[model samples]
Target chain A: MRRSMLFIPGNTPNLLMNGDVLGSDAIILDLEDAVSPAEKDSARILVRNALKHLHYKGCEIIIRINPVDTEYWQKDLEEVIPLKPNLIMPPKVSCAQDVKTVSDYIAKLEEKCGFEKNTVKLIPLIETAMGVENAFQIAGADERVAAMFLGGEDLTADLRCKRTKEGNEIFYARTRLVCAARACGIDVYDTPFTDVDDLDGLYKDAQFAKSLGFTGKASISPRHVEGINEVFSPTQAEIDYAHEVMETIRIAKEQGKGVVSLRGKMIDAPIVERARQVIEMEKAMFGGVEDDE
Target chain B: MKITANAVAGTLESSDVYVKVEPCDTLEIEIESVVYNQFADDIKASVKEVLDELGVESGRISINDKGAIDCVIQARVETAIKRAGGNK
Candidate 1:
């Protein structure tokens, strides 16, 4: 149910302390690109202490550790593992073996630290062309992988294509990731909209992501959270239509009919099932009612 | 155990403390806190409690405090002592 996942730099003390009030469904304490090499150690210590002491109001805490190719990632894991963040996002994940290597490392750490096995979830960032080619295998690499994040900026760089406001360059990459994630029954997230000042553009991009079947979007700033959440949530009209389709299908089932008609439209099994999914998504997004029937 | 080397822990950030431990013949403390006039005594007592718990008999523990809470202060001091004693 993560509509917006915000990235907060791990080196900034003020932002780390104020993370709980930011209103994002999840917070990513970034220890990689946001932190300078000189400040890497300090950021790791700060993030570790924050995870041990601070509470983000039950928001999922995700630590974007340094990439696996660096010396800092091992230390990052050693310090951050004991505290147990909700998810660990590995950057530059170029293949399925990358996911497996990290998963194995986490498994060993969990055993040594006496933590419940498989408690830590992984959401790997697919940022390269190699990663895009192997998206399906990466998505199904491990049981702990709950989602795949498509990183557009880096992917465009890997493709040597220019990034434009219209997002035409990333269409193929995003579409591929969506299909791969859906095939594995896991969620997929879009990269942060880099133009922080363009609210209109952000809205358009979020709407496009939603249409492309992204469950949520990653945000670089706090202001983008509300917009992303709204774009991904099922609208009131959509909820009403879904309920109508469900009711019609239920009546048809009682009458021993294999098909149903709603407003002169043929409602088959797949259409009704999609409607049921929409209703369920609405409930998950705004949880006030329970499905007893 | 006696602190035989210069060791440090924590940082001088908000809600954190930078602790440095040096070998000395007797227990010595130098605390520089933002709230020196208000919570100086309490801060010193907290550091002393942690030092005693670590069985540190002699060391010069320098604390550069930035409004860190009691638990953070204790953790910083304990980490500094362990680093100085080579036990961590």
Candidate 2:
């Protein structure tokens, strides 16, 4: 799972070329709202060529195409589908049909370009109340969908609610998105923290999202990546306890025991499962170096 | 391909290069770059390479560079050439 997905303006050449080195787990080359209308065509060309030419150093390349209803999205798909971005993020997705529209177009592009089928994934941004209510359907709309992202700014605007750093107004929508994504068995990413200069607020917001079970957070700037990554990653103490729990469970299994105890506390199946998840998460983040004997 | 009309691509922004192409009897390439004295030869070579690849023999290519790298330069030049040739 990604801890942070950095959004870089697709038309900004310097950012597009250097986004991978910013330490984000994924880099989003955004051709949607981040780009101006006059530069839409130019941005599409730049993003397509960037995908064709640049290597993102193992960071998952996610291109945020313009909304499905726009004229720019089809052209964006035509230009970048052959290049095979890791994910195509459709912004302001309101229903399952929005996801299907992009998916069907992608299938056609795959057949025409002869690229490997199903290589391009989709992550629809849930921005409206309809999108949040239909989140599960959208998440399960296509097998190609890997995750769903909650777009708080646009969502608040759509809901006619005030957006504050505490994010109390969006709590219901955020929790609903998490539940929908979990029910669909796909990851969920929280919206970006807009206050770039307020690292403390960013940290608190990221921690809040993590508590809500978001797998990652979107970053508007590279400066926020480090904070989000730290918040999402398992701590050393948690990793050590997970290791101990696993070892205890393994010993119990060897002894033909169904119940296990570690540090005077009985370990249940759920505890053991959580331990395994923590270990797996640690490995995914640290490249399995923590798993070394 | 020969340039038939005036065409331009890209913008005069930082890390971007603005390219202008117009019809000319003889090829004349001019560049104004932030790093003109340092990487002028590399930039000129990149532009020439793209011109050769497009098979454009005679055209006046004016490049207003703002420290764009080779890839950006090549993309801008190719786009300008395509526009000049009335392809897009």
Candidate 3:
């Protein structure tokens, strides 16, 4: 249900206070790239206090901790894990070992804090060339990895290429990640659309990602949430077609027919599965309230 | 815990408060806030609560607030006290 996860700077109190009301499905309280080194401790304390005192309802709470390679990550985890955010996003993940390292630490912390095992989940940010190469292994590294987030800006830099609106450079990596995550039976998220002002480009980019099997997309700006959610959600026509597919299947089963066809085309297992997914998505999004056709 | 040297935390940004702590002979707290007329007592109470939780005594605590809530004030105070070498 994470169609859009917006990034809110961890140190900015003003933004942190209003994060849940911004229409994002999830709000990522960022401590990695958003806060400066000098203010890392301050930001950590502020974020911890915000989580403890403020009630952010409806939206999932994700804390993007600093990379495992840095000294700040341990401190970040120590402060946030006890509060039990929905997910902890580890950046610059290069391999399965990186995921294991963070997951192992979380397991230890969960025990020490007397919380249920695997209470905190991980969303590894795959941005390096090595990470893309080992996407499959990383996706299946641990049980705590709920999803994989593609960080296009960092990935392009790691690839030694310039990022563009067309996103041709990241095509291979994007497809590879999708295939890996799908094969592992986990969700995959596309990177944020960096150009906040260009709504047209954002829509096209999101559409392309959805076509390539991205379950959802991250957003750096609040303005991109609606467009991303719209792109990922099943359309009215799709929902109606799903309902027809299910109804036809039900009728075929009751009639003792060996085969079923909808609109003169065979409704096979694959089509039925896709229709089920569409129907499930519609239910989740609109609470099973069907719109007038 | 004691404040051995001067330390500051937080920024004067909107919805934030700047906290500074230093060594003093007796406990002293000074607050200058945009919402002074409305929430000065609550702000002082939050600062004192954090200091008490950290076991901080005998220090000069100063707050420059820009309408920060109680949590923000407490966090800033805690961070400043920690930076001043206050161990709890």
Q: How much does each candidate deviate at the interface, measured as C-alpha RMSD after superposition? A: 4.1, 1.8, 2.4
TM-score, per-candidate, Cα-based:
0.86, 0.92, 0.97
CAPRI-style quality class for the chain A–B interface of candidate 3:
medium
TM-score of 3: 0.97
Q: In candidate 3, what are the lDDT values of residues A203-263, reduced to their tens digit? A: 9999999999999999999999999999999999999999999889888888999899999
lDDT of 1 by residue, A95-191 (tens): 9999988989998998999999988999999999999999999999999999999998989999999988889999998999999999999999998
**Per-residue lDDT tens digits of candidate 2, residues A1-293?**
68899999988888878978999999999999888887777778788778877777869999999998787898889989998889999999999999999999999999999977788999999999999999989999999999999999999999999999999989998999999999999999999999999999999999999999999899998999999999999899999999999888777778899876898999998887788888888878767455422
Order the candidate numbers by lDDT, best to worst: 3, 2, 1
The model with the greatest TM-score is 3
Candidate rank order under TM-score: 3, 2, 1
Candidate 1 local lDDT, B18-82, one digit each (tens): 88999999888999999889988999999999888878889899999998876567767876787
Fnat of every candidate, listed in order: 0.00, 0.21, 0.79
What tens-digit string does per-residue lDDT give for candidate 2 at B1-88? 7799999988888999999999999999999999999988899999999999889999999999998877788888887888788766
In terms of docking quality, model 2 is: acceptable
Superposed on all Cα atoms, model 3 deviates from the true structure by an RMSD in Å of 2.1
Model 2 residue A129 distance off true place after TM-score fit, in angstroms? 1.6
